[model samples]
Target: MKPVRIKRRFSLGLGGFTYLFVTSFIGLGAISSQTNLLFWTFGLMVGGMIVSAIYSTAMMMSLRITRVLPDHGAVDEPLLIRYELTNRKRMIPAFGLVISELDGDDEYLRGKPHGWVLHCGPRATLQAQTVGWPTRRGAVHFNRICITTTFPFGILSKSIVVTQPGRVLIYPKMYRLRRKALWDIHSRDMIGSRNSNEGGGSEEFYGLREYRSGDSMRHIDWRHSARAGKLVCRDMTRLTPPKLMLLLDVRHRGAWPYDTAERALSFVASLVVQAYMEGFDVGLAVAGTPCPTFTPHHGRIHRTRILHALGELDFKTDEPGSWSTHRARDVNWMVIHAGEIDELFGPPGAHHLSDAELDQWKLNHDGKSSRVNLVTRPRRGVLIADFSEGVS
Candidate 1:
């Protein structure tokens, strides 16, 4: 077991100040009036401050704290971090212990919050819970906690800095793809229905069945139906995965460059989940200095890998210089790029920015990209630095 780090600090609190003030007044009266009673009163007041200091310091020193973190955390989600606080002293109990992460006034810091322990019996252990929220997807960390207490006497307060190494990976916040809006994509027939072999389609043709009402007109085997003098639809085994290539383009293209980039990343996360669940063999392409790539595959493990990689993206760091042939050469790639050219990185906690707040973030459109792509697609295996870069 590692040693529990304990540092002590003392500050005059309400009760301490009142006692000191009275003592000072008594000392003044005793000196001027030659009153021995006032002298005794002054001595008692000074002694009380000394006692308060000792008691408060001991309460803080006798306690040790260890943090219990969850398996993982996610952006924009509440994660509970547990603190097990134990009092080591046999005779004295500790009270009003506040354990909190020290946050600077700078707006970019997104880390843990504070927790409190109201009471701990002598030589006993107590468990307290703290809720931490992550505002960004990536590595979240904590190094020290500010533990404070004014135990025994409300007058004297002591705070100590407890140092601990802490780190947790935060997965990207996923949004469900709006099915209603996606209907437009489906209607445009942009979602490829792979077909080639005589058995036809990705699924092998099993046989034919009488056309039911509301059946897709496209499924009708007209030749077979004519031969049988009845309306028939082809039945095919549902196999062969739908192949999709997700291209994350980081170039900012429009006015709300920061908002657009983050929103695009979120949308990408949602699409990955949606595609995988729908049986799409999904591959990922990212433009980064050391870009992380995944071949189109299937399984829950693959999904986890994707989410983990997605969480680590620092958009300002990576750039897809040119499109190069990645793993699969035949992917029907959908390239989603946030091609806004401005380099303004938003607040670190910008991921938590509300719509109203984001709207306020917009400034003069000093956008370098002559044009913006709401979203775009590229040919399978073809690389384009930007959609406007023209397909190879």
Candidate 2:
């Protein structure tokens, strides 16, 4: 570690002036009156200030500070960052080390103590810990770190300012769609496959079969026909359906409280876990950014990848326009918002539904809409239960 050179600034102000006046006046009076006791009193006051400054300065000099950031942290999730202060020199004991992170607009501030102080023996190292919670998703940059000390007496404060730059990238929250919604989407794809042609064209050749009357002439294998002395055709297509894409809407209209959004996000994460378990090719799409589409796979590795993304989700906007308008029409969409559903999704010309009407609307259309359904819509002011406990 490089040595941090710190300059000390101490102001005596009114207190120092008072100390000087009282001590000097006593010393002068002792000289005139030939009193040795008064002289000793003046000398003691002067010696205490000198001794305090040297002790505090030496304490600050012997200490070394370093920060440890968490490997992973979610948006609005509390994370611990440790600041280690090691006492390098054996001569001085470390005392009253105050470590604080500077406040900034981009920084997330917690009301908890920003830094800690500790006493250290010769060659002993002490660690100070602070907690950070992210308010929004993005890259969080911490540019300033301060370590200071006011040991023994409060007269002198020695300090160091560190410009260590670090950042944490936050991804969008992963949400689980309603099982009814997921089933409806999955069923739609399965039903579509029934009407489509069964074999050839797109699927890999499965080997030669005896030619049937309906078999296309192009599928006839000339080489096989010559070898077997019988007409044969290759099966070119299989009956497998296209993979279902799961699109998650993570954007909200107004500035909802941080806790409210995080709770909603955690719910989404649970949904993704459930979907991955069921062996669906689960792709993720946030409202704003282009997410790497996960072509759904079953097994433990796929589930881990989905959960990793969910753990780092942020809700701040990075793109323009409403997400509803930009949503992909082909894939199934599941939206998680903090406010009114009708305000977010109702037709442009229709009047916004009243609270009573909205409740009735959800009752009638919940789990029964074509193409799309409001799976966990709230009625009145009641919040929906988390999706992990099974959708109600």
Candidate 3:
């Protein structure tokens, strides 16, 4: 591991700049009027600005910075990246220190990429945090960690740039999926495949939320709602969904629209998560993009493997999508952009989840949608993510 490099920088803040302007004005007046009071005030203001700048810069330079990346980062979710600052000097202490990310062109960071710390004793290590919500799924590379401060008088701001090479793999955003008709239909096929005593059989009380349109009246928490003065519906997670294999059939027309592809990938990620939670064996078959072959299986490892393939999905937009035309046995395929399946094996579609229907289903509109699901729609004229050319 190469040693981290730290560089210190300083600049005049708004207050410092105003102080300079006032000092100049006062000095001019002093010279014109030959007034000792004005001259004294001008010299004091200039000295104060200088003292503020020097103090802030010295404190910033004395600190050594390091960072801690999360185990895994997901798209559009708050991921806390930690920073540790070590005050190297034996006599001096650090105060009002902040750690920030040095981002490039990607604008996924929601708020200002900085975290604050009240104080750090001499030779003590202090921890701070910066929150980053990845807008898209992929590698989040950190070129540097910027530690900035405007301590004491707050007249000048100083920044210390540390060349820290850090990056993390971020999974695609999982959407809330309430639609269970497709899963219930295929679960019967999986019946007797696993012993009744082996898998999760009964529904468990999960959480409480606002009542939806089609919720069972028996499931409603009447007493709790009456106490809280609102209709609170009871949510549960005791039932399993089903096993599914995703067959992606997409073809690039000309140029790949970035927006369209992102939305499509997000949709896939959401489905995989919902299935896994419901104990579904999830797999993938992409036509164009070069991704790993994930056989249908159920488990945390299997889900990670599928998500890793989705994150590494990258290819020229002009190149059409490709996948083995041969179909897998003993598995129900969930077709996304999969072309006509005349020569293919398995059912044409165990469940055809139309993107249009997903878009039409307003999840927030009292519909019985799953809390752990994703909802996204591609822009007009935007198409193709791991798809091949021409009609399937």
Candidate 4:
């Protein structure tokens, strides 16, 4: 475990101020009227306030918080961030502990996210979870964790600010790809039906050879062995899934560059998931950005690598360059560009999708109808870097 830097802060809450005001008024009355009962009540109220403040301070000071966050998240999905809260003191039990994020990307989040714990006994650790809905793609930074409490009485509140900076890569917004959209790709190649030269599964027969000592008994051919007077084994071929190579061009081609680029990214993201579900080896290459080339492969790790690279793309650092059209044989290439598609680079028969055709390929969140139009509504000459800075 790394060392956590904590800063303690004390605050007089609204209830504290109200209680103090009423107690002061009663103290004044007791002094003016010289009533023993009123004086006792005033003293008791003051004592209670002091005790509440002390209890709250002690409880807050004896607490420790550690954040357990995921490295990646998807847009519109619940990002469950957890925290481990431990009561350090032997006797002071913490209650009503509220852990919140401070100086983070709150605009990208759906609501004011916070974790709560009803009670954490002394010398005990408890885990609390909070959910955050990310609105868009990119990196979300968490600067600090604030643990506050107004325990025992709501008179005073105390907080401990822990400087635990972290980041989560937010993948582009994904949607269900309609079956019609897949039919178009299926027509291009016999997906997942091709046989590879590797010998493994029983899908296709590769050849026959002498049976090895450790060969499976089911693979031995009895008729061939009897004729040859030696044990023979069948070598079966493994089926190779089809491949999808996505070329994402996010260069500034028109007025609404940022929105157009975002839409193209989301479309590619959805297609990546769809292709993986259909058993296609997927690869992604981003134009103008400094992202590295991703080769066509099929696996959960490969898919995550592509998505992470997409999330880290920044137009501000993009260079002026043409799209790489290093076409691989048998790999179905799909060029997805933002705005105009005039400068796209691919084979003549390669699939192409521009801003106009994005909504057609995407399905709604509930998997019902076509996606709503995501075209930006006239942001005249707004630079992509400026727009991203404003959003963050």
Q: Write the per-residue lDDT of candidate 3 for residues 269-382, one digit (tens) a residue.
A: 777877787767778876557666577788898888888888777745445455652544556666554223222332443434434334432244445443222222233211
> For model 1, where is the 10-residue window of minimal lDDT?
346-355
> How close to the true structure is residue 259 of candidate 3, measured as C-alpha lDDT?
55
**In model 3, which regions exceed 4 Å deviation?**
1-3, 31-34, 110-112, 179-182, 188-242, 252-260, 315-328, 338-350, 360-362, 365-367, 370-392
Roughly what TM-score does model 2 have, to 2 decimal places? 0.54
Candidate whose lDDT is highest: 4
Candidate 4 per-residue lDDT over residues 1-392, each given as its tens digit: 33269899878878878988999999999999999999999999999988987888888888888888887899999999988888999998888888898866866777757878999998999889999999988888887889888878887788889998887889888877665455345553453347888887778899899998888999999999999999999999987777778888765644565778788888888888888887788888777667777878999999888888888877666475444546445676677878777432555445566755665655556565443222221343111110111100
lDDT of 1 by residue, 281-313 (tens): 777776533457787888889987888878777
Residue 176 in candidate 1 has what lDDT? 45
Report lDDT (CA) for all predictions.
0.64, 0.55, 0.65, 0.76
Question: TM-score for each prediction?
Answer: 0.65, 0.54, 0.71, 0.86
What 10-residue stretch in candidate 3 is worst by lDDT?
383-392
Model 2 deviation from native, Cα RMSD in Å:
11.0
Clash count, candidate 3: 17
Model 2 misplacement above 4 A: 1-38, 103-107, 111-113, 170-245, 250-270, 273-282, 287-291, 297-333, 337-392
Model 1, position 131, has a per-residue lDDT of 83
Error of 4 at 343 (Å): 8.1
- Ranking of predictions according to TM-score: 4, 3, 1, 2
